[model samples]
Target: MLAEAAKSQFSRDHSDHLALVRAYEGWKKAEEESAVYDYCWKNFLSIQSLRAIDSLRKEFFSLLKDTGLIDGNPSICNSEGNDANLTRAVICYGMYPGICSVVHNERSFSLKTMEDGQVLLYSNSENARETKIPYPWLVFNEKIKVNSVFLRDSTACSDSTLILFGGSISKGDTDGHLKMLGGYLEFFMKPDVAEIYQTLKKELDELIQNKLLNPKVDMQAHRELLSAIRLLVSEDGCDGRFVFGHQILRPLEISALSTKPSLFSRTESGPGGDNSKSQLQTILTRAGYTVPMYKTKQLKNNKFQTTVEFNETQIMGQPCSNKKSAEKDAAAEAIQWLKGGAKESHEQVNHMSKLLKKSKKDHL
Candidate 1:
């Protein structure tokens, strides 16, 4: 929302959140009793909007004063939140689980979420058109699905921001391994490194809880803890990435599945051969889904098995003698499953089928 409001004042050179802070500071610096109109006009900002924001800011300060959360002066509170990195961390903290992973490849980058595997940011986001985002994560305020899933009002999040404030961190099975969002976000460190983070997090959590309980408590009293937290948040940089969902078949499992030759055919060539894969891809693409991807792996018996993935669905094919046959078999199975086979209901496909049928009938 503040994107356009801040752009003229702060230029699109920093994270979206920092732009707002810069714009507000610049506006305040330029504002005087009689010069507010000229300043807003010159910067292309709305004068009424600035007035409303000032009104709301004063109201919050008054409310905080009444609750004993702040003294008469507001500058003291500024000592903590005024730092840009801390401000970003606080935003990430409030927007926990509302995060996306930034994946960059040769040509472009994409965003992914836990629920919907692949997503995109709305065009308004500063990061939407970026080909390479330095950070591994983005904290977003909202998401909606129209033509496709879109994240809105997102700010790039550093490894430190998400690790320190994003979600509950859990100890993994191995030492120095940490997991967040039920293992979706993984943090790897030396054994001693994990201990340090856990300790700092505990102290920070305690300090926040104490401040919540005792409004009169001075947060500055824990200067050492805050300093350490700030140092980590700044210096650690974005050294990690969120875990994206994909599966590698275990060797033993693949061996067991490969042994069942009696129940399966060696290839999908009898009726559905090479053309099946293309047919499946066409159908899915026309239905507004990604073209299916085939993952082929060689087995111990020198045979290949393939898994075709699309729309977050995965279907494994019978083991075949070659990569080509394995992929064909995989696509055949996916096609059969989508046409309403034993794998269960294909609600999305079925819904699209009905719409297509209706359109044909109307034309007739």
Candidate 2:
């Protein structure tokens, strides 16, 4: 039926094509005695339909053989002879960026796309009314919004598919987490996953560049990369969620920095060290200011917490896993204080420091 439909100009309409494909898929999986099987057989038993079906079956088998996905004739190849994982991966390769996440404690799903927000499964989907969904992730063909968003031709996919085929990934706020789609989506996984993902991205990029440089070159290596991507997409167990990174919901904006001299310059040791306290102290000393002394408190959890009073009117607090880290955080806060109109000159800093010291002494 599919072959006949493909050859007939009348059956080449989009609706007819979609219906034929869906029916064929349903027929392949239907039981011989089932209503679905009967429906497909009755609808497609015409001489043209039968001829078309035969041609399609032959083409499908030839493709499987060419891809080395099958060793024998497809007509005799049973379901047991197929590699389900490889087949799903191949499907994912074409349906990438069509990934969706299941809603938490909800019956619906959400896609990470600009056009669609929440999507419902098509009534004909096997997962449409299932009580317990088999997979948390799904790869869908397309979404149409009528009264609400509807996912067409959806298929359940593993977590690996997202990692492999999803859009660009960037570091998340905390360690061992990654943000995707310019921070629209987030994933928490093993740190190794991040490392592996970076490596894979690099490899894929190089292959693309090579292909671009020599369009006619044998693409065996490129094909291998694609296969690797498919394999990665079949892995499981990476939790994901939709989130806005840095409180900026839209894409980030880039701007040139002001030409003004920075309050401090990074030294060889870097910003993560215990130098923040010393940096603050040096700035204060050079300004000839003695303000209220900064205070550091140790939390019950053993983490260091520090509070720095930038002026009589402004204060900043920071907490870190260790005393050194806490000091670094406080130092950064102090720089922002200066930049926010506290004082840029040494004389101004010294005056502020003196006022702070007197305030502390008076309180004592």
Q: TM-score per candidate, in order? A: 0.62, 0.43
**Candidate 1 lDDT over residue span 1-364, tens digit each:** 3546546456353366666566566667778456767667666777677768778888988898888887886767676766777788888888878987765443466677887778888876667657767677888889989989998878887776787787778897667767788866666566798888888887888888887789978877898988998887777556243221111111223344334332222233222233768757655543334568889999999999998877556777788899998987777666665543432324434432432332211110
Lowest lDDT 10-residue stretch of candidate 2: 244-253
Clashes of 1: 0
What does candidate 2's lDDT look like per residue over 90-204, in tens digits? Answer: 5655676776655332223333343465568776555564443444456778887789887776666555555555566777665556766664455555578676776786677
The best candidate in terms of lDDT = 1
Model 1 RMSD in Å is 12.5
lDDT at residue 267 of model 2 (Cα atoms): 30
User: All models: lDDT?
Assistant: 0.66, 0.50
Candidate 1 stretches greater than 4 Å from native: 1-14, 239-364
Q: State the TM-score for model 1.
A: 0.62
